[model samples]
Target chain A: MQSLVIVAHGSHLNPESSAPTYDHADTIRATGAFDEVRTGFWKEEPHFREVLRTVEGDEIYVVPLFVSEGYFTEQVIPRELRLAGWDVSEWDSDGLSADQATLVAEDIDREVHYCGPVGTHRAMTDVIVRRAESVTDDPDVGEGFGLAVVGHGTERNENSAKAIEYHADRIAERDRFDEVKALYMDEDPEVDDLPEHFESDDVVLVPLFIADGYHTQEDIPEDVGLCEDHTEGYDVPETVDGTRIWYAGAVGTEPLMADVVLERAADAGADLGTALDDVRETTRVATGD
Target chain B: MAEPTSDATDEGEASGDAPETDPEAPEIDLPADAFDAVLDALDDRDPGEPLRFEGFSVERDDEGEYVLADGDSSTPLDERDLHEELSERAPAVTDWYAFERVVGEFGPRRAFLRWIEDADGETVATRYAALAEGIERAWGELKITATVTDRGERRYDVRHADDAGVPVDELEAHEDPLDARKLVTYDEKGRYRPLKTAPSLAGGWVFPDLGPRDLYETVETIYPATVANWHREREGGLDVTHWRETMERQSGIYGVVKTWDRGEGHEHVNWVAEACCDDSQCLKRREWEYDDETDLDVDGGDGAFPCREPCSVVVSAARKWTRLESEQPRTYEFDLTPSEKEQVEAIIDAVADGRIDEIREADTKEGANRYRTRFLRAKLFDDEGNLGGVPTEPDEE
Candidate 1:
């Protein structure tokens, strides 16, 4: 039987790291499509190889629920999963990129599809804008707000900030807000610099992580002067010095992303015909009961 | 059939305790010249004219103090060798290599299904493949089904494991679940690859069914201590005593993990943590077994730290635990010594009579206390299946 293996960076301490992954897996499973839809985490239950046990037959699909196609998606995951090929080459155009097709040993007759990270999808920019736009009364006609894309940048690798930077630029090009800035948790142009970089007092901070793990929920919020750890779909509010702050939950949890997932699976030979992007209806349609 | 293993003796019918006379122990009574009364009755041959008495097949009471039946009549046989019989019947793991291979490929739970499918019905192999209690303890019921192929080989179908009401065949026909953590970017050029342990991650095998224990949670709870011990061991240069004790309490099994050749190939184990806990990543911590022989190996074999009722910890330890065929298990053998032949027969009588605990509770000797505890670890011999032989499976009520 074919199995869909979702690989996420589960948390040892943060429940948020794995909760969304579990929720999404449960939703996708409700569709009754795969013989098995299981989540394996870097940190959580059914940790990596444990999830592999559920997959017995040749058809295996591994999707990294990562925000970006960086070190983890390319090197760590492929190496750990023993994916057919090295996730070495950088990806282009987001969903279902065949650019990273890794070769397996000759004995491996199984069909394995390694898909792209969630953040690179075209539909993702919409979610980021929506998170920033949701709290405003009239986003199109009224006052334009500043938006900050908070990512886990690195001191060692400049490439670490690529996805966040890319998403921030894409949103900026749209001109929906007065200003857009890319901030990092680890490197230059940090979140602390967001206030100085944007002229507008009403700035919204959007974490571009695949899930609201320790980083998005705890780290980013702490860095942005908020006390609460807000997750996906959460429209929680915190403000400082007349600047109203809106932390849209994780962009990866956007209902639309579920549709993107289906597209990626289909592109990998799952052959789901529909091209619909109604991921928002995932939970409602996926109740399975 | 052979005699089951007890905490002490590895030898069964050849056990050293048989024909000796110990003055310190009381002698058991048997009716003289009863024409092998006890032996013949226990081996009752004719099903058509089967013997039945007192709502149980018997000729005498279980305590064996008196014969309840005469020769052609019903009565208990005297001087029965019930203890040895029980000992012979305890669960003995006969095939270690095949068992490990199955577990290595299918994890613990699925391995149980494979065992049943291979054995036709559950045998000693499948019976203990799961928790000592088996499926009832893991999922509240045992419902593994098998379809016979034209070749007469059994093909197992494991659809009931899920609550979806979907059969295995149907799921396989159209299977693709979404990754809850994030969406997978699919690449047509991707080919299948076996998962290998990342050089930098913690890694091990997965045990299938862990009875009722949730091993992940168990690992989580003990993770801090393991990490701490890892540190202590790294600095303290590996304290075998402390690490062994911690492992025994946390996971009932003991084995080792070390520098391995990933190229040699491992069976179907799913995940491999990059716990690449090299000297750089991990230290002399609690989680690491002492590199006793400094032979951290690739082959995973298991043995007890000390025989105790296993909890989920053994499964955890088994993950990193491996063994090579050359090494032998440390087994102990001794003849049942003085002051206890009386106690042994009395205890057997209590057991066969169905009042073992009562008999045990009534006795105050520290020796009797030790005996009962040891007996508890003993897997009684059962020709049918040892899953039905022990006291730990779950109370039906």
Candidate 2:
């Protein structure tokens, strides 16, 4: 039997950090697809290093629960999950042909197969579209609202911007909203300037983040003029300057994210040459979507 | 005289016999409260254990009341209970003043506090720290654990995650699953092997050294640069297959330079490289490239050419340059032999252990240029090679 492990960069304080990743794992397991499914985190307990020892499978599929491909996804995860002492670049099918490979085997490293994060999947577009629609059902709300995919874009890296573009294009294709834009905490499209980009009476801004952290509660809202005005009654007016903007939950906040995780498992399993298509097909059939 | 002698003898015999002490009568006793007092002391000393004691009489009072005392008192005590009492007295949570005093009286210790919510004082729950300052202030109702002074520091397994007992399905669905990268396998020659670490790009992409390129691709993926599509020209470039073909055929520095450019509109490129003139070794040949307005600039000189003048002196200088230029932010991939990697790792360990001086002073054979440079730079030695102003200890402040 094969095992699938999903590694998340969970926050020590935020309960929602690993929510999406684990939720996905649960959904996959509910289908009785894989023999075992487990979780581990970098900032949280049972750390990234010890993840390998927690399972026993002929083949293991590792799917990173990261929003965008960044340093953690690239250098840190690979280094931490590297087979004992073996180099990641040189490992092969027949296995390591060097002293390092021998040392790794002797050390009892787990067989690992990693898949791309769920953020990169084309299917994820469906989640964003549905989220936008639920926020503003104003038949003209799609045109009146500007869709801002708020991401945690850092100044040091441009690769983080790729997810926003991927998501933006996906949402733009639906034609559900007039303006689909990308905004960052550190980089361009400052949250404050979002009000300037649209002529619409109201805007519905969706954050493409995975958890409700400082960005969701404090930064993103503060960036746009969503400050609570004590004088304007308790009602959070869904529109700004006749531009109605509704906030949707993070991508990881979706309850159905578990299905995406199952999709990742299927992808990883396929990569490892143990195709579990029948199990996934069953899910599609059962859901009858 | 004989009659009086018999009477005296009778009296003496009676006195010596002393009423042949009644066999059934008890000997001695004490204040009734004494028994209760001793039992109370035993109960106080050991609350959970069963109490056992015996009383003995030593003498009789004038009224025939016995004088008794507690003797052979052996109260079986529960050590675990006693230890618990000791632990409770020296709680982990204390005022800053008390904490300072504790550390001084005994030694430094790790103290943990269980946070209790306001609704139910008895219930403890983990809360996110809104700011770092909140941790230092007075905590909420807490259940603390701390070792007593003079005993030793106590080790605690801090439960860091939510124990509300999330269902296994919820756990796997949202959490980072276990060993997602199952890297367990070997070949005939015994080398560590990855299932597959190749780049599978969707759109057109081209670069040199596919191995390193793919590795960089993975690196780029792991650490993506979310460059906004400034041009707005949707999809004019070649698909991923053709771009990879271009990278495969390209060779020399110029080959990479020429092949990297995408036409004006929707033109986007990122470069990565590995070597340079800073080491003073790669003077033989310099590697460089120019496709679009890239952020690819050699650190030593304004343009790539002038900086890598004697680049020909260095072996594989052009290739190294290409790799460096191809990286996102002009990153370099030092092609160190495995032994070199091991050496660097050893130096890292030494520095970590506060033994930087050992590496700094080691002979040329043991401490190579790379090791020496890293140590000196890490130690913050001045340009003149003076260590006076440099910090010798690790920085905690």
Candidate 3:
């Protein structure tokens, strides 16, 4: 049997950070798919080094629960796991990045399959729709709203912005709303331009991130002028332009991504039919969905 | 022998044995009403767990009595009905300022409310991922999983097409059942026309698009077993043959390439392919035609776009495989002198019968990487007994 070690970029200040990854690992383990499903993080206890030593399995699969291929995926993760691939490259997307197969070391006694970041999968668009629909409250009013997909855009890489735009285009193609646009924290069509971007005053902004870290909690709400007090913003929406802007939690934290994780394993050759069935049964018992 | 030996009272309290005086509670406000008010506060705490107050405990019994326990002494505080007395001593919190101070007095609720105050709340993905997650788990119950097609259309592969929960049979009659794409029509301005009202197009074709709400409602109303179409199983695992057939018809971004290990010096050759890149306009998705015999693009695009670069997916994979063939150390198959080979074979045979974890316990060799310290450490072999090699894209129909 194989083991899966999901590596997440956790936060010390925020306890909620890295929560989704751990929750996902639990669901996958319950499916009885892999020999073991363990989670390790950079900021939290049972860090990567400790996790690597404790988890048991001959065939280990390490998946990064990040939105895009950037600093953490390329640098911090490899250094912590002590993976033996090129550390840096000319392009941020270059080198042993997420969503690909990379051998850890030449003579490691076990086979290690390193997978891509969770945020890049196209199926994620569905989760985004769920987030948007949740706070829409009134589907009648939502019919006239605009969707703004906000991301942590860096001036350095175009790939980050490309992912945001790609999802926005797909959501727009669905024609659920009157208008849809992709905006960024550090780039053009900034989130502050919300009122100007939409003809309908109502808007729904779903953060395209893996966790509700500093950015989703503080930066986004502050930019939208919807912060409740000095510090944090809840998943609930606030009014902007006299219209409600339903803010959703990060997209990467959803349970549907667990299926994607299994898909990653199956792509690397771990059979998951039995586990998938078991997991579905368990979920049915839990929610009757 | 002034007092008969009594089990109810602490024997050491000889001077304070009188029932008129109460036991010492925590030092603070001295009014008797305030103390009773604190006891009355037991109504707020959950009954399953006992709440400790200083050295004493306040808990609600299963019979609905608020019992205050001081060591072995148990007082049914609520049975005594002291709310009127306690209400007078407890601080009034009618105003906002008084309420703030009163809240400060609440140790556990304050902490809980503090967390609620600070919480950034759940992300949209979490709420929705849950919805999508439930659908996947209950796929058999729903009779279908609503999935996004490769072309990004949302549809379902109803378990029984004719007896589907949705009007799928009627919907499929207008469009190709195999294609599963919605029928859409455009108005003169090119805006999408509504299916319910749009006029017939050429050949009497009609716009029959289903909105997000309509599709979900229809599925909830009728579909029997909706399945999620995952990336690896792009066809929701229901139609593998057809899915594979479709994949084979399109251009792929990567192909398994055959290469020789020049560095290994064992006359080794291997077959490799690019990890399947799903980019719609993947660098390898060329319009140029490949030779049926050679499996390589023999002709430049006469009109269609052809593949250009080796691609990040292929280049990275190629780099990895090449490194594996060249670097570090070999564990599964290693070169040894003819004389030492027989002893190694004996060791290998001894370890083969048991599980890898158990066999690794008695061995004394340090592995070549960071992760080996935790693993049972064994190499996988194919049916032919050869060491397992690089992963290849799954076979198509």
Candidate 4:
């Protein structure tokens, strides 16, 4: 009976902005894994706060459907979930117990747990590399060509770009491509400078966003000078300092994204013994009449 | 209930699946009013019903228009009050607002005057004061008002040059005439008056039509490049279907963008050039095209021009857009008193639903004409989850 809440970044302008999360929820619901699974977006209705009120589950688990572990995951989600009130510092073990007792004594004891983002799983590399390869047309062989993993880095948290770097390093270790580098929209070694920094004549830029939006279309293209004529398919064939810089599609909407969500859910369940039972108990308590 | 296997059964199965999973249980029952009618109409649904209706519920024809049991006993659904109640309560949540804005704003002005039907041309003179206040608000503090009505349709309105009722020459000479007269207005004595002069601006909102499918399709055809550009940017694949539908709906209600031929007395085929630029970086026009060999310059070079220009001009390297041609100009201009914009927005919203034909005539009888020809209709469903047709048509009124 543990209800699953999938939090997505929705937009008032585009209905498709929330499509992937909705589709994932539908697919997960079809499996009959959880009693209730619902979606809410930051920008769209049934907003994040409203999403919390939607389900009657004693044990609620939140899974953020975001591309990076940025401000939304750390600040916005926690602020909206009302879980921050009970959350003591990580080192405050005694405070944790005090909070737990307060929860237990209350008429409705709600114990909430959050799972990691879909982008964190080690298996996500497969989807990324595949999407990169699918959009890349560079025939240059071996290790000479460069792979640039572009992410929407923020100034809020210095460590926000770690996820993008981790994926980049993972791909670099494989050594299939000559050099792999992590670039960002906001910070140093910017997306536009990839062509000059790499030794290879060909550079493949992949956007690590959940959706293709303003950054991918306007900012990225303006920075890297993507060919305005080439429409459909995420290949950028613009010349930078006489080098061919190619652009890859955003990673969020990959067909394998559904598999990644399932994988993350499974991984989160591994630590909790009798997870289904835990869900059932939590739901029963949460829905107390 | 045993799960059936066909499409109809699948739909029913899906609904039942959600209810079954929940612990709560309810015994389904046929209402006394719907019992015999449901049985009789089991196979006699209208041809237009299935194509245009989705996520709508049908109840007793509340307009009391339909004949039931040989016209012996029929009760009206009171759709007027129902619509009024809905418009008052949940106007924003409903998906039908898209069409409502489109059909309602299909007139002389791209903007629609609140809920009024067939009031075009000279009729606009009646709403001069109301429109003046709206213009003041929209234009950002102008002291303008309608004065001379020579042809009745044509208006000669003037705005005070300054907040102190000064003429244009008295204000800063460098400022553009239009910019200097931001939403300011004048009273009957030609004295400058702010919001205190006219409270009509405080009232209802005005709207523009989004248009029907045909217009949307044309605009889409014209702006395929822009559509593709938007599609390329989303993580979820760009909803080409929805985009096309949006454009068609916009075009139908807003009409087409073309020039008129004074000699031929017909709308001439023309293409509108849109300059897309990001002001954050430099204004470098990205894409540009021309359909005709006319000497058109898009760039209004230097000291502040509108984001869009009515005439062709050169653009910077950052601006990206293309030219699209149409068979003829479908444009028209009509003036609304003031509240038309809000009504137009509602009408456009209704038209965008893509389920216009399903709206029942009974449900929208009061606002049917204004709602119909220009606006599109969509059906609403009951809590029990039944298909209800649209309750009104524009032509009916």
Candidate 5:
């Protein structure tokens, strides 16, 4: 039997942090692809340390539903998953880093294929572009609107901004949008500086986050002037400082993300078998099939 | 237990003596694979030896076919057909897979279900019927009810114990177990529940249908590792980090917790445990004491689950108290009447026991009542909110 374990950062304060992970797990489970689809959390129950006990399969595929290949994906996940020699303490004095590549460890009882996080996958670029296009009604919205990919960056890890910059550069190379810029929540070119960074009057801000938690729902909307009241939801195409801001939901919530997770699993050499087509047939909207 | 067996015996007598050879034997609807797994497990044991687990015993008869009996039964052994006996004795035994799953898994779910079955102290058939009728168990402040679904699968419902009688429609229903995290973050009074195991969980919400795994996950979300720790302690495997060891591991801003261990015979640790680890303060029974060697005077509480170590709330509060304890001793003199001194002590006791909320404003007879407290304040306290017109600190002049 084969299994897929989606690991995400759950929150003690907010329920929304783990919503997307559960949604994707449900969608994936409905396809009947893997024998089992389970979820683990860093801050919640069935913690990463004991998540493996829930899996009954000998061949397991673990996909981190995080937005970046930073501290969690690189160190904490591997350490907690007990992936062979990746058992070094997260706060180790030696400062050694776990391998960030698609890792497959057979040292444990099962063959655990630890895939790269879904947010860092190449398919996430399509998810970001789709999110930006989704908020507007224009058939050719990208031609005139600037796209700002908002990421929760940190000064502690430079790799936190890599996925956002990679997606931004990739989208910029496509030349479909007038401009594409990468923005961060902590680093330079913060989410609040979206207006100053974009040349287009109408700009779209797409949060490259794994969940519609405090960052996507409150912080990004308030920073872009879309949310006047913190308790209320925001509308798209809201005017912020004379610039029309079109805000999209977090990229991770997109239905296409289910496909991205499978892609990450496939990249890590998970045997999708014949069920892979069923998953794409049910979840993929971009294919227009 | 006697009631179900009597009922089964009545059904058998109603069917007559040739019940084994009766053409209309009740269908044995046990899951094929799960029964085989049970058979496989039994096969591992000695040939004639019965495998006993959670109020049920399974073994093979002389014909080499499987025979299951209630471990609690005192009846004589008979080589009856498995189908007729099972259908007559335990009609609710369709979902053997659920039993297999719970017994096969080596974790909290298995331990919890086994505990539930053993606690019932009934025959397997009677327990199955009770589960079908929805038997409720209390885990901390949560009410967990396990019911056999129409498909012969076990479905668990979890809600606050206070909301046990409330209809499902009256409460918010959750599908995912992770939603319990948000439910446990605050109390009904909208106060943040700093300790997850505190008995302040908000009610009017229920996860009315969960699988065994999801039920375990939901309970864990609400109370973290209480079940696992409880089970571990029962099995003599709980790695308890006592107050001293836990405090010594504190670093950075919380490093002051280590200073609390002044070798004063752990009297201060007893105070910390008394203030934080009580049944009223936390739902987990305090298993950790001053150290592995010394035990505290305060009771560990009658909680269903055990706390393996000092929680973050205890550590954080201990740090604050440590800093306060380091201050130089000072003496302040105040004169009060006998009743006033007793009233002050009553006020402190009321606050410490979290009974201030129970003291009604209209019940002015109570010493801690708002009107009585106000009357005392008016008669004694000065305008600076000082007790008995005495300043805590001496004037600079």
Candidate 6:
């Protein structure tokens, strides 16, 4: 039997952080593509240590529902999953990218395939592009809009900025929008500097985050001058310093994310079984019908 | 059989060719396969003898083929028919090892299974029926329900006991057990809960359908190791590190706790237990004392789970109190009526018992009511906020 385990950084304070992981798991379970679909969190229940014990299938596919290939995806996840041959000591020296290749490990009796984060999947670019177009009512929304892809970047990990830049570059190459720029919450060219990078007065800020937690809801909105203080809901097309600022929700919250997760699992060599039809066939055979 | 003779005449009798028959040491053939192995375990019973084990009954037919049935049932069934029937009635009986693996061998799962099955007394069919109807049990702040699905698989539902009467649709549904971690982080008043086992968990959430493992994960997430620790205490294997030992092991910032040791007698430690380990403060029964030989005067609470040692919160608070106790004592004269002094004591008691929130603003008769306490502060305090217009520190004349 095959299983899919979606690993995400769940929050003990904000329930919204792990919402996408659960939503995607439910979507996958409905498909009946795998014998079992489960979720593991770094800061929550069925913690990384015990998540593996919950799996009954010998062949498992693990997909990290993170926005970037940074410390969590490369080091913490592999270490917590106890994936064989994962050396934490070599993390700094090797500078390994967990998304560079599919990590296959013989974890005791099971064969575990560690896939890349859903946010870094190539299909995520489409999700981001769709998010940029979602905030306005224009038939040709991208024709005069400047799309700013926002990411929670830190000097501690450059890969976070790289993921946003990669998506920004891909979106720009399509020339769907008038202008595309990458912005970060921590690094230079911060989200507040969105107007400085774009010539278009009509600018759209899309946070490349997994959920609408503090960053997407409070921090980004505050930084972009969309609100005076921390607020839950925001009205789009809010004017900021003469620039029409439109803010979209976090990219990971998009329903299309379910497809991206499956893509990540398939890329890591998971056999995407023919949905519930196979289950029905097996049941029929077992009952001699 | 030969009659035994005395040693003096036994040599001639032993050598005589009537094969020496020992009544006590008969060569009996051992059983083969699981079926016979079970019969062998029934001791002293002849083959084809009717047998009973809890819910199951076994008997031999006229052809000598073993037939099994429910203890309450009259129809005897062959092995194949029994497997088919039990696969629906009690899947655990058909696959006992698999069931055990799913429910786990330790902690609440073991206790829950035993409670439903009556610890080997109830029939498997009865146990399965009970599971189908669902057995609800309380684990700390959680109300857990264990049930068997149509497929005979065990499923669980976990919710705050306070929400037991609430409709499932009204409560937020969570699939991942991890959601409980977030649910228990704060109380109803939106204050952070420093102690997970405190009785102040918020309600209005339910994990409506969870596997046995997920149920364990959810309970563990909410209360950490309380289940395992409770089980360990039940099994008489709980290793408790009392206040004295736990204090001595502290280092750095917490190392000062050791200074307030047995030298001050167990009075201070008793106060510590009364303040921190009370059922009102925490939901764990304090198993630790001043030492293995010395027990504190304070009650250790009647919690379902045991606190094997002084938790970090207790130790940290002790360190602060140690520093405060080291200060030189000075008397500050405060003019107050006897009733005022009694009111001060009542305020402290109310706050200590966490009943401050329960006191309504309109309840002015209560000494610790919001308006009453405010009035007391207004009447007694000076601009510097000292009681009775007196300075806390000595005035440098």
Fnat of all models, as shown: 0.00, 0.00, 0.00, 0.00, 0.03, 0.00
Specify the highest-lDDT model's number.
5
* DockQ of predicted candidate 3: 0.02
Please compute DockQ, using alpha carbons, for every candidate against the native two-chain complex: 0.03, 0.02, 0.02, 0.01, 0.14, 0.07
Candidate 4 per-residue lDDT over residues A1-289, each given as its tens digit: 5667788886534445666776666656655666666666665534454455445555566777876554565556655555545333421322111111111211123655655566756666765776565556322233567888888676644544777787899999988888889898889878867777788887777787777667766678777767552353334556777777777666776655655565555655523334434332322212224
Which CAPRI level is candidate 6? incorrect
Task: Put down candidate 6 lDDT per residue, B277-296, tens digits, no spaces.
Answer: 87777777889999999999
Model 3 misplaced stretches (Cα beyond 4 Å): A86-98, A105-108, A137-142, A228-235, A274-289, B1-397
Tens-digit lDDT string for candidate 4 (B118-187) = 1232222223323322222111112222221211111222232133244435443221222212222233
- Name the fnat for model 1: 0.00
Where model 1 places Cα greater than 4 Å from the true spot, the runs are: A84-87, A90-102, A105-109, A133-143, A154-156, A227-235, A275-278, A283-289, B1-111, B114-397
Model 6 regions lying over 4 Å from their true place: A49-57, A60-62, A71-85, A88-96, A100-116, A137-141, A274-289, B1-115, B119-136, B142-198, B201-353, B365-367, B376-397
Docking class of 1: incorrect
> What TM-score does structure 4 among the candidates reach?
0.38
Candidate with better DockQ, 3 vs 6: 6
* Pairs in clash, predicted candidate 5: none
The lDDT of model 1 is: 0.43
Could you estimate the TM-score for every candidate? Answer: 0.46, 0.38, 0.39, 0.38, 0.68, 0.61
For candidate 4, chain B by itself scores a TM value of 0.18
Residue B377 error for model 2, in Å? Answer: 45
Report the Cα lDDT for residue B190, model 1: 31
CAPRI grade of model 4:
incorrect
lDDT (Cα, 0-100) at A276 in candidate 2: 40
Candidate whose DockQ is highest: 5
Candidate 5 chain A lDDT trough over 10 residues, lowest sum = A90-99
lDDT string, candidate 1, B105-211, tens digits: 33333333333323323343233332222222111111223332222122222221232244443443211212111211111123211111111211111222221
Q: iRMSD per model?
A: 14.2, 20.2, 22.5, 20.0, 4.3, 5.8
Worst 10 residues of 4 chain B by lDDT: B1-10
